[model samples]
Target: MTQAPDKLVQSPVVPHIVTELPGPKARAHLEFDKLWTSPSVPRAYPVVPVRGEGCTIEDIDGNLFLDFNAGIAVTSTGHCNPKVVAAIQDQAGKLIHYSADFYIPLYAEMCAELSRIAPMKEKCRAFLGNSGTEAVEGAIKLARFATKRQNIVAFLGAFHGRTYGSVSLTASKAKYHAGFGPLLPGIYHAPFGHVADLKWFDEVLFKHLVPADEVAAIIVEPIQGEGGYLVPEDGFLQGLRKICDDNGILLISDEVQAGAGRTGKMWSIQNWDVEPDIIATAKGIASGMPLGAFIARESLMTKWGPGAHGTTYGGNPLACAAAIETIKQLEGGLMANATARGNQLMTGLREIQKKHPGLVKDVRGIGLMIGVEFDSHEHAAAVEWASFQRGVLALEAGMTVVRISPPLVITEAEAATGLRLFGEAVAEVAAKG
Candidate 1:
C-alpha cells in the first residue's frame, strides 16, 4: 500500500491531491504559458504551483505535491521561507539597488558571510553576480585575468549556463549549443570525474593542444549536476587539486547546483578535503532570488586590478539579504537535516532499485542531492510522469537520470512519504510496461 509514516500522515500539508492532472485552472494556465512563455524552457509536466511551504507545493488546481525538484535546486531553503522573505522585504523597503559598483550594507554583509563559510584556506574574495551562468562567466573572466591565460578546460556533460561564454563552457546538451555558432574560443571539453581525462589533459592537451601555462583553469562541477548526478570516484578531487598545482592551473568548482549546503556541506568539495582555488555558486544561493557569486582566494583575486570585472546589479540588495538569511538558516539546522534525510531517501531508492532491476539501473546521491537512473531515457520519463500523477514533483538530469534535490528543510517523515509514492510510481510504470 502507498502510505506515509504515521507522523507524516498526521501532518496536514503533505502531498494531498484534490483534483485530476492539469485541472481546468492548470489547463488554462498551460495555454497561457504556451502563448507567452519562451519555448526554450522545458517543463516536464503541467503543474502550475501557486504556493509553496517548506517541501510542499500547491498547484493552482489544488493538488499538493512533494517538491523534490525545489525549482531546479534553486529554492534550497524552501519556497517563501519567512526569514528569507522578511529579509527581502526589509532590504527592498530600505534599499533596492545602487548598482554593485558602490558599497552597500547587504552586499558587504553577504561578502563577509560568504568569505566566512568559503572553503578556501586563506582569505577569500567574492564577485557577486545575478545567476549561476553569470557567476560562471565571472569566474571564467577572473581565471583569465588572474592567471593571464587564454584556454580553459571544462567537463563534457556540464551545464554551466545559457549565456554565450557559459554555454561555450557547457557541453551537457547539444541543444544548448544548437545554431549558437562560434562559441567563445579557447575553451576545451574533457570527460568529467575520470583520471584518464586529467592524464589526457596533461599528456595531450597540455603537451599537444594547449600549453599548460596558456590554460587558465579547469572548471568542473565536483558532482556533475545535469550530467547524471554522478559523484566522482574517491580521490578525484584530490587528484584534481594535484593536477592544478602541477600545471599552475586554477581548479574552479562550478558549485551552482551542488553548493549552498546541498551536499551535506557548505560546499560539496568539502567532502574531499581538497580546496579549490575558486568556486562559482548560485541557484540555491538566494532561495530563488536571482543571485550568484564566484568566490576565490585573496591572492588570486589580487592579481587583477579594478575595472577588470564588474556588474551593475550584480549584488541586488534584496537578493543579497535573502541569501544571507538563507545561509544562516542552512547553517542553523537544515544542513544536518539534509544529511539525515538524504540517507533515508537513498536507502529507500536502493531498495526500490533492487525490486525493479530492469527499470532502475542505479540509485546514488549524497545529502539531499540524488539521482535514479533507469534503463532508458524513455523509461525514466515514464516514471517521472507517473510520479507527477501520484502527487510528487521531480526533474530529470542527464539523459536517463531523475534528479531529486528537495529543500533542505524536508522532514524525515516527508522524505519517507515522497519515496513511497515514488516507489509506487515506478511499480505502476513497470506494470504498464
Candidate 2:
C-alpha cells in the first residue's frame, strides 16, 4: 500500500462534492469556451475551480483537490494566503495601478528587496516586467546592449516563454514555433547539461554559428523547468561561467521558473556556487500576481538609458504589494520548510520508483520543482487523470514527465501524502497497460 501521511491543515472548511468533476455547470460554461475560443486552447481534465486556500482547490462541483501543481508553482504563499490576500486588498484600496514613468513606493521597496536577496547584491540592478517572457526579453536586450553582439545560445528541451524573443530561445516543442514564421535572427540552440554540450560551447560555438565575436550571450536555466526537471551535472554552472568569461559573453540564467525561493534557495543558480551576469525571475515572485524581472550587474545594466524599455503594468502598485508580502513570507522559516519538504518528497518518490520500476522511469528535481518521467507521454497523461480522480491535482511538463511542483509552504507530511497518491496513480496506469 502507498503511504498517505495526514499533512494538510484541516481547512476551516473541508471539501465537499455536489456533483462529479466538470459537472453540469462547468460543461455548460465550456460550451461557450469551445464556441468562442480555438479548439487547441487547453481544457484537459476540465474542472472549474471555485475556491482555493492553503494547498487545496475546490472545483465548482465542490470536490476538493490537493493542489500539487500550485498553478504551475505560482501561489508559493499557498492559494489565497491570508497575508497575500490582505496585502492585495490593502494595496487595492490605496492604489491599484501606476505609470512606470512615475515613481511608486512599492516599486522601490520591491526593487530593494529583490536586490537584497539576489546573488551579488552590490553588483546587481533590476528591471521589472509583467511576465516571464518580458523578463527574458529584457535580459536578451541587456545582453546585446552591453556586449554589442548578435547571437544568443539557448538549450535543447528548454522553455523560455511564448513571446517571440523568448520563444526563439525556447526549444522544447515544435508547436511553440508553429505558425510563428521567422523568429528573431542570429539565435542558436545548444544541448544543455551534458559535458559534450559544455565542450561544444567552448570549442564549436566560436568556430560555428555567429562566432564569439558576434555572440552576445548564453542563456540557460540552472534547473530546467518544463524540460523534465533536468539538473545540471556538477561543475556545469562554474564551467559555463568560465566559458562565458573567456568568450566575453554575458551569462543570463533564466531562473524564471526555478528562482524566487522555489529551489530551496533565493535562486537555483545559488546551489552551484556560480554567478550569472543576468538573472530573470517570475512565477512565484508575487505569490500569483503578474510579475517578472531581470537583475543585471551595475556595469552591464547601465548600457540602456531612459525609455529603453517600458511596460504599462510592469511594476504596478498592486502586484508590487503582493510581491512585498510574498518576499516577506519567503524569508525566515518558509524557505527552510521548502528545503526540508523537498528532501522528504525526493526520498519518498525514490522509494516509490524502486517499488514500481515499470511505472516511474526517473524522478528528478531540485527543491519543490520535481518531475517523474514515464515511458511515454500517453502513460504520463493517464497517470495525471488517475491522480485527479484520486483527489490530487497535478500537471505535465514536456512530453512524458509529470511535474510535481507544489506550494513551497507545503509541509513534509503534505508532500509525502501527495507523493503517495501519485505513486498509486502510476501503479494504476501500469496495471491497465
Best by TM-score: 1
lDDT of 2: 0.83
- Candidate 1: which stretches are off by over 4 Å? 1-13
Compared with the true structure, model 2 gives a TM-score of 0.94
Worst ten in a row by lDDT for model 1 = 1-10
Best by lDDT: 1
Candidate 2 lDDT tens digits, 1-433: 1122333334443333456766776677677667788776655578667677788887655567888888888889899989899999999999988777789888877887788787864567788899999999999998998888888999998899988999999999989899997998888888878755687865677776567778899899998888778898888778888988887988899988888888889889999988888999998999999999988888888889998887888888888989989988888567777788888888888987898787689988888888888889999999999888777888888889888888888876667778888888888898898
Clashing pairs in 1: none
How much lDDT does candidate 1 score?
Answer: 0.88
- Candidate 2: which stretches are off by over 4 Å? 1-18, 38-40
Clashing pairs in 2: 16-62
Candidate 1 lDDT at 353 equals: 95
Clashes of 1: 0
